[model samples]
Target: MDWLTFAAFALFAVFSGLGAAFLLRRFGGSSGQWLDALDRLERRIREDLVANREEASKAARGLREEVVGTLKDMAVLQKSTLDGFGAQMGRLTNSLEQRLDAFARQIGDLTKANEMRQEALRATVELRLGQLQEDNAAKLEQMRQTVDEKLQGTLEKRLGESFKLVSERLEQVQKGLGEMQSLANGVGDLKKVLTNVKTRGTWGEVQLGNLLEQILTPDQFMANVACREGSSDRVEYVIRLPGRGEGDGEVWLPIDAKFPREDYERLVEAAERADPEAVEASARALEARIKQSAKDIAGKYVHPPRTTDFAILFLPTEGLYAEVLRRPGLMDALQRDYRVNLCGPTTLGALLNSLQMGFRTLAIQQRSSEVWEILGAVKSEFGKYGEVLDKVQKKLVEASNSIEDISVRRRAIDRKLRGVAALPNDGAKAVLELIEPADVEPD
Candidate 1:
């Protein structure tokens, strides 16, 4: 039994013994019968206590047995459950293994099929590549043969054309050589002509005359002019300038050509020889010759009021002019001392053109008053013209008014004759003849 049941049984036995002892003590002075009854009661109580103890022990043993049986039943149930769960797990594992094997087999089959397809595709590509290469080779060989044949023909044609062109070029070269020989002979003749002093002077004069003729009108300039009074020193050309005053006569601008060919040739030769001393000597000689020529022109041609204060000395060749210009301060010296201006062909052309412009300006200045008078006359005539136009406009207005009056009279006539009916052509003409002649006359 449990501790509580066992303690209750022990307590019952102790109380029974104490109660018997108490009765014996309290009834000691009375009789022995009271003590005997107490004894019997204690014996009965002890018997009951022993009996209760046996029942509690039996109940405890029964309870322990029930608990052990329940535990055994639970252990059996758990074992069965574990067995069922293990079996289910084994079946599931077997099913998964079967499915995985099938899946692996499918994967292997797909891999074989893929490999077979790749091999077939590779074989087909190889066949196609071989066929294509064979076709390309044949085409390339055919193209090469065609190109070779065309190239051969083209080369032959080009070669023939080249030969023909070469022959034509050879003929042109021969012709050019002939022209060059003639040119050389002409150059020799020109050199001979230039060697003479008179011929050189004539050449310079001809060049100067050509430049003047080209730039100036014939009437604008004079040939071989004696610029000074009672002087026989005639200049080659002279351009006439307008006089400064109305009473003053025309001024002359003298241009004379000079060529010191010998000195110029010597300078050219010394430069070509690369001899500094010879070049200096030749240059000085040429400069002296030019200065002497300028002095001669200044003395002979320059006459103030008759001619310009300065005269032009013309150099025919630009090379000679350039050499003269190269002489340091020579142009300034000539202009300051001799009153002579140096001119090449180009410079003389420019000078003549400037003079021509000056002449035109002078002509325009002389005619400006006349032009103004003409404009004044036109202005006066324009006023009279305006008056005449006003009269014509008035006449036109009167005529227009008369035409309107005639239109009204014609309409009235037509209204009166409308009731008379139409007439034949002869009758109409007879009627017109019978009408007043003044009515038919033109206004």
Candidate 2:
């Protein structure tokens, strides 16, 4: 397994080969020996005898060194073996002493085991006492568990009663709250109606304004502005229509709020009847009122002084809107004179949203124009600042050049100060400080 073992085996093989080689030299054919001799018959053989002898001597020295090394190794092994024997003898004496120690320990162990047996007996008695104590503790624990269970049952009964009472009270409170909520909703509806009534104009104006406000938008049209110069019948509002008219002027729109409620109620009552003649008469009466109101609005809002392409009659009530639409030839007659736009609450909301978007867009454009002007002014100011900085930089360079030589400037300043010292003190004369003396020299 080791290199030394392999080397020993190899050396033994070499010795055996040497023995075989000697035997072969004695008994082998003479021709083989002659061939071996002829192999050394080169031209350089005789010329390099000293070199060959030196090489042989080196090989002999290496063999001798190997033999000496092997002998030295054998001596080292012998000395180590002797030292190992002495150490083994000393270890044997120590082992014999340890055995004597074991004999004494056996005596101590027997004495200790006897004491341990007595202790074990005492521990057995203590273990029985502990068992008795555990039993007593277990009995006490059982009594405590029984008491805890009884108390838990009593507390659970009280808690369950309290929970049931609280649940009943909560149900009652929820019911009361629901009733209050319903009452609040009714009050809110009433308040909304009153608010609508209060926000509109006078009794007639309030009704009309409320109807129109609910049915039309404020931004798309102007309300209650003068119709014509010195005119008593002021049109309610003028609507600025989308398309431009002739001469690129804005197209006009008419918006009215007046409605006849007496005729409307009569018609509704007549509509529920089976009498055709009565129904026709009531329809005629309602048509007459519609025509009269339309004619009045047209004269006030769609006339020569208040001319408009289209007009609107704001009908706040849904029933009124349906009734107007159902009237045959009524819309045609009104539209023939002036384009009439009839709107209810829903369409009115859409119109208001459109007007809001238009206003917002206009304001944004105006604001952007102002911002552009401000930015342009800022750019101009920044350009002026750049020019001023360049001027300042030139002045700074001139100043720096004037004081380039610090020692010369200091001597010149001292000479000038010595000349100024000869001047009279003029603390009370401010004029002398402002004007230099005419006779002053450059020295």
Candidate 3:
């Protein structure tokens, strides 16, 4: 029994023994039998109590030992868990630090890109403005020369008539000036459009889309594609690479167009003003921007096995594309670090053409495989036809041999008839008797 049950039994025994002893002593005082019975009961109760005590002690000792072992195991488990947790924390800390460093580097590159774009835009604006000024100056000089020539001619001819004509010419000059002002306003509006970052991006996307439409079919490329699983962010375009062999799925090749026009403008402005320090600064900035763009493209779009290992960064304008190429180690760095490919309009067109050719070649190979299978089937059918022809030829030969045997039998019968005829009347009579006729009486 359990400890509680054993204790209950022992308590009852003790109470019963005490009650019986008390009654026996009260009812049978001085009786030897009653005293003996009470003594026996007491002895029995004492023996049971001693046995119960020993069992309880043993059980208690066992329970204590079990609890001590459990505590030791728990302590060991706790230590192991703590060690694992500490190692995990260390790994997490290192990963966090590396991520932070990479993020900081990316931020620095973005800042440089912004600086470069501003410089390039400034330079472009200055150049356009200078050209416009030169054109205006030339027109003014031409007008001045025309006026001087008209004045000289008018002085030698009718002075009043010349002055009236000069006033009309002045009105025409004013009209021309108004037109020039309108042109200048248009240029200002264009500059404003280009200055805005969103407008520039929109323009670049449009240009990229137009080029793609011209070069490839609609099925060949998809626009505004979400490249990653469980992501809402979209890339501008992705080319669909046709799969080779049966059951192989199509692969994606992502293309992102980036126009860092603002930095480019800043660089142009600095160069125009002959500021060596600013130009160098802009150059460095442009380099950083290109690098950052490549890195971003690689991170966002280039997923190996799903997409190509490398992604393309398209620069719409040739000048920007050329500028990126001119940077020392820039292209190599982009390819090595980011798995990014930089392509301008012309180069991208060529690449698309090559891809198209590859697709055509794959199609041809598939078709060839199908044709070979058909040829194999045809060969199998031809073999069956040859077997049928052999069977038919064997039947024809058996029929010919039967016809020859029948002809030989007919000739032997004819010879026997001839022999009977040549034996004279005696032989003919014997033959006739052998083929006896029916009796006349029966008819």
TM-score of each: 0.52, 0.34, 0.43
- Candidate 1: which stretches are off by over 4 Å? 1-188, 273-277, 407-443
Superior candidate under TM-score, 1 versus 2: 1
- The model with the greatest TM-score is 1
Candidate scoring better on TM-score of 2 and 3: 3
Q: How would you encode candidate 1's per-residue C-alpha lDDT over 348-408 as one tens digit per residue?
A: 8888899899889988999999999999999999999999999999999999999999999
lDDT of 2 at 55: 68
Q: Residue-wise lDDT of candidate 3 within 1-443, one digit each (tens)? A: 76655685879677776868686767776677676777776677778777877777788889899999999999999999999999999999999999999999999999899889989989999999999999999999999999989988877677767787898899899988999899899888778767887777777788889888987879989999988887776889999996654787888999998889878888889989999899888988998988888888888887767788899999989888887888889889898899888999899889988888887787798799788999999999999999999999999999999999999999999988885536576687787765435533453
lDDT of each: 0.89, 0.68, 0.85
As for candidate 2, its clashing pairs are: 224-236
Task: Compare the candidates by lDDT and give the number of the best one.
Answer: 1
lDDT of 3 at 35: 66
Number of clashing pairs, model 1?
0
